[model samples]
Target: MAEETKVATGYDTKVEGEIKTDAWTTDGEIVEIIAQDPVTAESEYTEMEYRRLRWKIDLWLLPLMWFCYGTQQADKTSVSVQAVFGISQDTHLVGQQFSWLTTIFYLSYLVSEAPANYLMQKFNMGRFLGICMLFWGVVVLCIGFAKNWATLMALRALQGMFECTISPAFLMITGSWYTSREHTLRSIIWGTSNAGMSVITGLINYAVGQHAERHPGGLAPWKGISFFLGGLTIFLAVLAFCILGTPRDVRWLSDREKRMAVARTMANQTGSDRYKRSEWKWNQVITAFKDPQTYFFFFTTVANSIPNGGVTTFGNLVYESFGFTSLETLLKGTVPQNAVSIIWFLFVGIVTLKKPNLRFTFMVVSLLPAFTGMLALALLPKSGLLWARWGLYLMTVTGNLPGLMIWTMLPSNVAGRTKKSVTATVLFIAYCTGNACGAQVFQAKDAPRYIPGLIACAILFGVEAAMMVLWRAYYLIQNKRRAKKIAELGMSEEESRRQGLLNAEDDMTDFENIHFVYKV
Candidate 1:
């Protein structure tokens, strides 16, 4: 008992509870098992020193994530880009086959989320993710070689399975390094890679399309686009393997620095900078299911992503139906529309940083423009006014905002390794379902207008907005209940603080830890 008390007290002086013996570790290299509370030692380092450390971490980590995320988005959207460039004609795709190509990718992606997250937990995240990237790149490269619709479907399924790890893995890494408050901006920076890559890849594909138009007998422009993107993805994968690492594995920090890094983020209440925990607690998973908020998130993901599926898979094609040439679709349509999305991402990031609790507000705010856009697209006559219809289509990019908040909230709000993992999987399953369904809505028969699809998207966005409001209320009520329990316990502030810190160290889920407050 005396030894247990000593070890427990030794770990964090501010924490006044007994830590489980199993949680104690002699592996000081990965996670320092120091005698004093790290927060005190962290105070000795100057603020500038901490700033410099953050700068270094940002410099090293953000760019790699940004590039990797961008590449993944580029690869996914390449199908849409290639569609405008005659991939359908060349492959003799007809009816729903083209739509199925998009649908199958997300179908496979949905199936793979849980297992991929499990593998990430069991292995070195950087290496595991790197291997997934490398294989997916090869799969993407082989897509260019596909001769028919069946071959394309086969390769797209493979791509979906491999690409499943990117978002969840990136979210885990983001949470591992930064505090909840800091995660928003950094996430936007990397998350906006989707928009960034859209613009960059748009330019590249446009140039390539022009070249293919010049040399029709040589390699098809769509094939060249695939090969080039695949090669770039492989290069980025090698970089991820070489340079990308978890906070625990990062070579830049010393033993003391690693401890301080972990200590600095203690205020997050959400755990960060710890070695991987391989044991999967079934109880935590159960707790996640029992939590009402889990279902709300799942619903929101499905609702928001239904539109996302429509836009991402067919945005370029929709613009083509507006009477623009394929190259004009790439340049005038895809690039500018994505640029608008970039602005939305940056706008939300800035506002959220200045006003932290406004996440739900921004989520609702994001849907309105999309709702209006979809209404216009569905109701307005296509021949009424060309530029006006195009303007309305551009407004649909606002749909992406709610989805971004959903991603941000996963790391910010959820606690416990197993619960977090389970929640992410459920959320992504909804995401996949929504995307898969979204792709099928704009059937080939509905071409030019696709009124049915637009109407569906508009209604879903409103439902999603309502769900977001309800979810926010749920969080607010839950936090109040937790606060009442804390008061009823009659624990002193210091004791409560200590217990909270200990709970965080134990990797307790929000439900398991009574003092854990949900960030609204």
Candidate 2:
């Protein structure tokens, strides 16, 4: 271990724990990277040189991230458009049976989410994800040609398995590129994509209703919608292949821009660059399972997703029950609630900008609408169709709420590559579980009213809220214990400094030596 006189970085290195070169030094040897420049000086760089952003873009990092993810949301959820077509009628799908299609999809999704996130570091995620989009597009296209119920179910399962990486990969990439605070804003922006799904629902319905029923031939409208959406996915996937660049080896930009990008990346992420050097490790999973915080994250993801179950899978179905034609239901049904969600998301994004310390408070606000929406639908006794549509609009958007915190907790708290992989995998498994459970939440037996599922969702909100609060408390407890242990040692600054430099393989041992606190 080397001691060093502190100096800031000159350029971004895209390196995590270890530095490629020292930019500045005063008196001390490089004992531990007390204050890294977060940059890798170029081969020709002088001691005075620093990284610079040669190319400039008008959009800030957060907004760009928001748009990318928003597009992602719209792209993936397009299947909702197929609900009004003759496809379901031909397949003979009922409420419970319909739920299986969704249930099985998330089951596959659960199996894949963690591995996808873990692999993000291993593979060039942009290319891999784009390729996944291509795969899903082909699968969705194939779905349009499916003949029987069994055929549709199989296709849906395949679609979910492929799409699992889309979001987690986005999260992993976002985590790599942004800081905790910036991450939240982008989260909401991308979160607003949930609203975008509804925004397009009307236009999609108009197109499908007018033409799908009787196109050039007797082809079903839903099939047309599926084919069209699948085509769009393919187009985007191709663009991604050409445009998307790997964070570890982003060669699209100039050397200066690359350095700036890396430095900015390192500073924002506080060193996620290490994972780029390696693939997923099983040890990380074991550590993640033991971490109490991971459980809390899981609870929140599942809780929020339970309410989300109604929207992603059965949103159009719920609207159809409101005594409106499919076209009218989609048009009138989706707009108002999406408007509310859009406003709330932007508001929350701004309000919570200053409170990075209280991330859960924003999540709580997002859940509030979902809880109320479900309650209103369950309790109110109108045509039931009338209130149910509005309730669904509100409930559908609730999923975006916890999503912000879910991402915030991962990179902000967990550090090891292995731990990160495990945390992501287990959390996503819980995510799939929540989604799978949600697929089963809506029952045709409850029909028009569906009070049982509504109440189940509402009760779930309470449990979720409590779990989030408890998760925060657990971290506080862990932090306290760690502090007490440090005090008990009563080591001098010099001794403490001495112990900090060992580059041992055990992260648990490293955790204690570095005085790493559990972030809430």
Q: How much is 115 displaced in model 1, in angstroms?
A: 0.9
lDDT of 1 by residue, 127-212 (tens): 88899999999998999998999899999999999999999988888887777777888899998999998899889999999988
Cα lDDT tens digits, model 2, 199-241, are 7645765776777545647677777667766776777777665
**Residue 244 miss distance in model 2 (angstroms):** 3.2
Candidate 2 stretches with Cα past 4 Å from truth are: 1-79, 212-218, 265-270, 382-399, 480-514, 517-519
The candidate that achieves the highest TM-score relative to the unseen native structure: 1
Give model 2's TM-score versus the native structure.
0.81
TM-score for each of the candidates: 0.94, 0.81
The alpha-carbon lDDT assigned to residue 436 of candidate 2 equals 88
Q: Which candidate number has the best lDDT?
A: 1
Predictions: Cα RMSD each: 3.5, 6.9
